[model samples]
Target: MTIPLPGLDLQQLGPEQSLRAFIGWWPDAQTRLYLAEQAVQAQVIYGGRMMHADHFHLTLAFLDGSSVSVLQALAENMADWPVPAITLDLTLRDVFEKPQVVWAGPDESQRQALTVLDQWHEDIWARLTALGWTQPPRRFRPHVSLLRHARIAADQSHRHALPTQAFVGDGVGLIVSVPGEQRSQYHLAATVNPGRAVS
Candidate 1:
């Protein structure tokens, strides 16, 4: 199978047995590079494993281990899943210490945008639940994981201020995650445009 985006070639990503997919929005090349640089900076400040820049994405829903037929059906059905274009301002650098994750996400300043993202997530989750997929029992929080296994002291851990970086997303992708020792590899199996579906 072959799927092509502006700078991505899915043919090279190879095949998958089951569609262990998630619905998410992918950033463009420039935003990707910026995220990677932020990861590097975070790694320098807090000792941890920095994520690959190419893997940076805003995940909406996790749909694990569905069949390829389901992927096809979802792609077709998503033409009616009209998502408005959203600009995510990455201004907050925070940590999920229990998970040892250092991440970036929209701050309180972008409350309206965050509200939109929350609603979008709820809409996708509802659709997935109706499809009989088990929902993970966690509140939706839109974040781009920058680094993993970060160790910080109690007083040292706080939200870091950074110059606002923006990522504009107009579509959602059905992405399959391939496991790896260093970092998980993600392949874009299909996409649902704000106005249409592309596969």
Candidate 2:
């Protein structure tokens, strides 16, 4: 049986307060349908909250705590970033066992793309640090988040597996949102064409 997809709200905050680099692409109708089905299945089996598919995204970098001038400069610097087009073949594996959060991760073929992005992140980090900004404690790992805080039970019925889908993405975006707000909405600050824009 088919299931309905969850609804979500999108927000766009003004410039200079928050920033991030990301890829923006929604799943096709078929994929969304499949995700809705899986979400219902997971909700029934796992007995926990399921993440709304519309909230899904692949984050490239988080740009927080920059002054207005710095943010403008950074925006100008990223106005043209040259990264190649990437097609990721995502697969669902039992990566998270506790507090189950289902994820679709890249295959071995996408490692180079991820590595290049990491290096780009390092470069960005150096630039930010030179301008007196600190880096985040955790390193970058690319993955598609499917569920969050999904409590799992130690029972046979809880093992309902979800199907994964592949996505083709070509562009990168800058996202901004409020800090310390539980349901603060994210805004798309800017978009860069990876194949043509300079990094």
Best by TM-score: 1
Give each model a TM-score: 0.79, 0.60
TM-score between candidate 1 and the true structure: 0.79
Identify the candidate with maximal lDDT. Answer: 1
Q: What is the lDDT of residue 125 in candidate 2?
A: 66
The 10-residue segment with the lowest total lDDT in model 1? 1-10
Score residue 85 of candidate 2 by CA lDDT: 48
Q: Quantify all predictions' global Cα lDDT against the true fold.
A: 0.72, 0.51
The alpha-carbon deviation from the true structure for residue 75 of candidate 1, after best TM-score superposition, in angstroms, is 3.5
Candidate 2, 1-199: lDDT as tens digits: 1112221122223444433333333344455545555656656645555556554555656655544455555555664655544445555433355547755556555676667657766766676577566778975766555666666555434322334466544345555553445654454544555334221
**Prediction 1 global C-alpha lDDT:** 0.72
